[model samples]
Target: MTTPTLSRRLVAEGLGTLLLVATVVGSGIMADRLSADTAVSLLGNTLPTGAILVVLITILGPVSGAHFNPAVTLVFWIRRDLASREAFAYVAAQIAGGLAGTVLAHAMFELPLVQASQTVRSGAGQWLAEVVATFGLLAAILGGLKHARQAVPWLVGLYITAAYWFTASTSFANPAVAIARAASDTFAGIRPLDVPAFVLCQAGGAVLALAVMSWLLGDALRDPEVA
Candidate 1:
């Protein structure tokens, strides 16, 4: 297999991050304006987030590999799907794109430069919830690519959607995403101070998933049983 270039991967990562954050921040502004004050309006935001995620993965999966999340990139690196250099580049691009997206969202909403969203996520249960949610997410991404290559992006989208509602943390499984959300201060954003806890849980969860996936898929990876 021919290796993808760093320049190419960086471009894909930038585009993916831009799209992800735009959809999130834009939908958030729209939802708040439309719903005013009601749980029913929240779907207006979440629906778009899921849609963008699926679209980016499908469009960019081959090029930048559609990591979109630092955790996802880290998992791939662990699994050898990505090189260390490539992984670091992708992560940097993700962070830059995320910050750009947040700034754009702030501009669109006419919010202050430093203004932040009010969304709250915390507690041990929530932290553990993030772990489970991220583990499932990483597992889905890794397993799909390894065993069920055809259904990769679609299945990942479904996993995120489900994890959002099922877990107490609502599946903000990506640190780049978590950081971007904090900027918008939308329904999706967590506070800057709260970020460490969420990121820590996410990282722990991803590491755990990596361990388990390796054990189960190691033999398959070594042998290439899929025909």
Candidate 2:
């Protein structure tokens, strides 16, 4: 098969991110509207996000490596799997897709087109959780690439599914997702003020993951996976 052009790869990244965030925001809205129980709403939010992730990654992986998350893209950039210029494009596409995803979800739900979230998701505990959550995410991707390339989608889906409950920040582990969520006032939203910190911590965690994975996998880092 011929290589996908840069434009096609960028489109895949944007589309994948759009769908992923739409699932997150859309499901959260549906769950919140349908249930009084926060736990039920969360469960509602988690499943579709995870399921869509698996689907999106599986379908778009070949096109863009399915680096729907800017954090994930950063990892590949650091590994030289992608160049600095292309990584920036990927991140820009992800961020734009994420914002559009929020708008799309709001439109579907008949909510405001643009909203600044009042949902305050901050504090050291959650910030630390973001770090851990992102770290684990990169670890999953890196490890799965090494031993189970075919299972990467499932690995990421399962990891986020579990992380949603375990981590205080619901494993937003993605800068694109986090920023997009800040545009929402729904159950899945985070305050816009909190997004920068989350993004920073996620970036830190991704870099940390690379360091640890490089050491842990030693010579195995010789072959870096696309996503």
Candidate 3:
């Protein structure tokens, strides 16, 4: 197979992230409108976000590896699978596209285009949640690439779906997505002030996962009997 141009890969990353964030923000708006119950709204938001992830990753994976998440890109960059320059571009594209996603979602819902989230997602538990969420996300990607390349979409989608419930901050694992979400005042939004810490925790988590996966998935350990 031929290598896709950097331009093409960038487009895929942006478009996929746009769609992913749109689903996240739009579904949050819809869910909030439909129910007053937090659990019900969360469930409504979770399913579409998870479903769109699977769809976007499947369709766009071949084009850009469908990173759509800066944390994921950061991991690949750290691993040297992606160049520093390309990684920077990928992150820029993902952030821009994710912001556009919030715009699109708001426009579709007839809400204001620009917003600042009032939802206060902070504190130690929230920070820890981000770390855990990002770590799990990286683990899923690395493990999937190692053993089940074709199933990566499902792996990511299901992981996020589960993480949204299990994690305290509802698993905003992507720094780009976290930034975009800070622009929204909807259910899925996080306060702008909260973004930096979440991003930092996410980065830390990605790096830690990289360290662990490197040792775990390498030629370090294998069971001949199991094989």
What overall lDDT goes with each candidate model? 0.78, 0.92, 0.90
Best by lDDT: 2
lDDT of 2 by residue, 18-88 (tens): 99999999999999999999999999999999899999989999888888999998888888888898999
Q: After superposition, which runs of candidate 1 have C-alpha atoms over 4 Å from their true positions?
A: 221-227
lDDT of 1 at 145: 67
TM-score of each: 0.89, 0.97, 0.96
Q: Give the CA lDDT, 0 to 100, for residue 20 in model 1.
A: 85
lDDT at 89, model 3? 98
Is candidate 2 or 3 superior in TM-score?
2
Query: In candidate 3, what are the lDDT values of residues 92-139, reduced to their tens digit?
Result: 999999999999999999999999999999999999999999999988
Error of 2 at 137 (Å): 0.5
Candidate 1 structure, TM-score to reference:
0.89
- How do the residues 84-162 of candidate 1 rate in per-residue lDDT, one tens digit apiece? 8877988899988887888887777787645576777789988999899889988887688677876777778888777
Angstrom error of the Cα, residue 167, model 2: value is: 0.5
Instruction: Return the top candidate by TM-score.
Output: 2
